[model samples]
Target: MNRSAAPLVRELQPGEIGPAAAGLVLDALAARRDPVIGVATGSSPSPLYAALSASGADFSRAAWFALDEYVGLPAGHPQSYAEVLRREIIEPLGLDPQAVHLPDPHREDLQKACDEYERSIAAAGGIDLQILGIGRNGHLAFNEPGGALDSRTRVEILTEDTRRANQRFFDSLDSVPTRCLTQGLGTILDAGQLLLIARGQDKAEALRAALRGPVSPECPASVLQLHGRLTVLADPAAASLL
Candidate 1:
């Protein structure tokens, strides 16, 4: 695939990010008869979700797909990506639970579960737009550093840095799952459009690398530049390095 020179990067105020992102979603909804949205869970996307919730938009026809989920968590675990999406996206937007899809992390046959997730996405006609949040270490979804660029939906081992960053969502650091099922770089890039959001100074370096550095697995998000249609939204602090 021919890589774009760079993604369209826009640095805006913290408050401005939400409405700006909402505009994009609203435009997409107006254009597509059936919209498939790829959802990301993290602080960076919280504002966008809030904006959508308040926009009085009708999302009944949309289908939501989570980007990743923690492995070995009991069903309905509060911190699971399923619950997070429920609390953040589904309930607030009044979306049907049946319209939202998440990978089954509790399955005994995880590889089959992953394959099924991929097939489900394909059956839905692939994602129209994918919302993304960058890890401090530049990981996309759970496709951590050192993962293959052409990877698909599968299991991935969490890096210590990633685990540490996510420990706040769990009772303790040890409670954070070491493994996750995630849509890999190849899977995410399949979307018709990609929208990445980042915030805070902690993300400055990662955002810089993803936007300006070489497309290397060491900074998984750098793969975004290889995408034909990608837009990055970041707060001034997060975009400082760029």
Candidate 2:
């Protein structure tokens, strides 16, 4: 990573990260009439969602967009991002389900679906703030290692590490979808601000590599260095190497 352009990193207790992140979102919403936000799923953001939900923040006018979706999961599958966001973020925050959007990985024409997703983001005035979680392998969204840094919304093969990491959500490793539709680095960078959350010692090395190592596709999260407004909030374990 380029140290000069690295994100402003903050080390906070696990319980504090959620309120801090929710504050950012609430502030953004207050500053704009209808701010658009991009959201990510996984363990890292659970606390943040909880805080937002409990804060009584108004999200009625916010437009929500998801980072990615598994390619083959059923529409209402309990593990699908849609279902996950509904339970974790949307319903809790009292967001209008009609205002939330996600990529359609199950569509027959996935490429077109990706294109439409991109267009929808642009039409909504782009994302004001994008919440993210870095994978252990340093992947951003589902743009795995070696993916183009300037890629757009598209289909990608999930890495073995990604599959294994997500296995906790499924009955078996084989149950995880091998492919996904994800917003590319270019799409994520388009946001006015980026907020990334990570916790646990398992993410320590990846967080270090992303913030202090050379910027490279091999560690996709490293691209955040090029983003002008990026904030990384992590607990001690995840911030250890930084």
Candidate 3:
């Protein structure tokens, strides 16, 4: 497969990015009878999710899968990725809650949980499209720097940078979970298409590293360069370096 092409990068006005992303989702939804959509949770994707919900689009036939989950949070914790996506995308869009899947971090056999998540993705016919966000440190999902490029669904130790970035969602930095179950870079690349959203000046350097820097484990998002179909939406601030 030809995976060396650079992603299509569109720098939109801050307010225009969300609606354009929603339009892409609508196109994907119409093309597939039962689309499996992989979604990321973070500030970058919040606007797209909000736009999708507000557009009154029908997501009932779509199966939503979270890219990762915190390892120790309770089932209903407000900060849990499952709950975050539920509140941000599922409930607002009136999706069937049962159709939304999250990696089960509560399982004692965490590896088994990861394996099951992979199997579940396979059974759902793989992800038709994946929505993604890059961390300030260049991590994708929870797959931190130095993870294997061909890694599978598995648990990963959170880097201090990641924890510090996520601290805003928790009561304090100490409350942030230090580990998570995340889909590997390989798993993310398996999706038929990828849509990466980035905003703000804080993401500029990471976005530069991801879209233009070398493809290596040091910048997990750089793996996007190896995917056949990738689209990136960014504000001028985020795409400044590019």
Best by lDDT: 1
Give each model a TM-score. Answer: 0.98, 0.97, 0.98
Model 3 / residue 95 / CA error / Å: 0.6
lDDT of 1: 0.93
The local distance difference test score of model 2 is 0.92
lDDT of 3 by residue, 130-197 (tens): 99999999999999999898889999999999999889989999999999999999999999999999
Best by TM-score: 1
Clashes of each: 0, 2, 0
Model 2, residue pairs in steric clash: 1-213, 1-214
- Candidates 1 and 3, the one with greater lDDT: 1
Which candidate do you rate higher for lDDT, 1 or 2? 1
Judge candidate 3 at residue 86 and give its lDDT: 79
Tens-place lDDT per residue, model 2, 1-242, is 23345578999999899999998888878878989999999999999899998988778888999999999888899999999999998788887888999999879999999999999999999999999999999999999999898889999999999999999999999999999999999899889999999999999999998888888999999889889899999999999998
Worst 10 residues of 1 by lDDT: 1-10
